[model samples]
Target: MTVLPEWPAGTVAVLSTGAGAPHAIPVSTAIRRGDTQLAFALALRRESLVRLREDPRCAVVLLAAGLAITVHGRAVVERELERIAVVRVDVESIQDHQSPRFEIDAGVAWHWTSEEAQSGDAETRAAVSQP
Candidate 1:
């Protein structure tokens, strides 16, 4: 079954088009199908929808706390006239940085942000130091 990272990965970065740069955004929600597939619920007119229509190959990244999960897959945008659809991904690979390892296979790699390596590092860095 598709497993969530140690922390909740609430957003992903996506390319607007096949050859465009990555654009990251917080996803509205994600739904799991069985154990190896996932569908991201999104509005039909979003940038991700436009890009997926032109090219089904894309990477979906999930970030939370300090862990990042990047999945490469062939995406199918099942859109309806109602302007809403699910971006279904036939997961080709999965990756994780921090873990005892994810429950699901068909994974690629794992990565931990610098902040995560040291708890509250990001927050500490963001805070102004009192001289």
Candidate 2:
């Protein structure tokens, strides 16, 4: 079981999948439902939907400033709201990147997993450069 973290504000959320070659889509309306569930709104019948339907496993990356938070999990179609569908993800892993970090320079990025998730490691972070 992966413990999830709260996504910070002013960041971009990206949904990624590994159904075939890696794929990712920018998510705009994602919100955390609880400690274990993450929900995001998207258009119905999108490529992201097809990939997720084929493989529920995915990663949601939140980026803001220069910091990134990645959450790996399994997602399901919760329901539909008009022309959009709501997807709920069960978080399974968490990796937070912070090195000399501050609220102003926090950045998030999303990517499809080329391999299965592993426990969080410290080697993935780089020095946060100020612009």
Distance from true location, Cα of 42 in model 1, Å: 2.0
Assess the local accuracy of residue 119 in candidate 1 as a C-alpha lDDT between 0 and 100.
47
RMSD of each: 12.8, 13.4
What is the TM-score of candidate 2? 0.69
lDDT of 2 by residue, 1-131 (tens): 24555655324688999889999998755666677777776677688988888999999987766546788999988766555666888888878765674553654444435443221111111100000
Error of 2 at 44 (Å): 0.6
After superposing candidate 2, which stretches have Cα over 4 Å from the reference?
1-3, 8-10, 65-67, 101-131
| Cα-based lDDT for every prediction | 0.53, 0.67
lDDT of 2: 0.67
Q: Which ranges of candidate 1 are over 4 A from the true structure?
A: 1-17, 64-67, 99-131
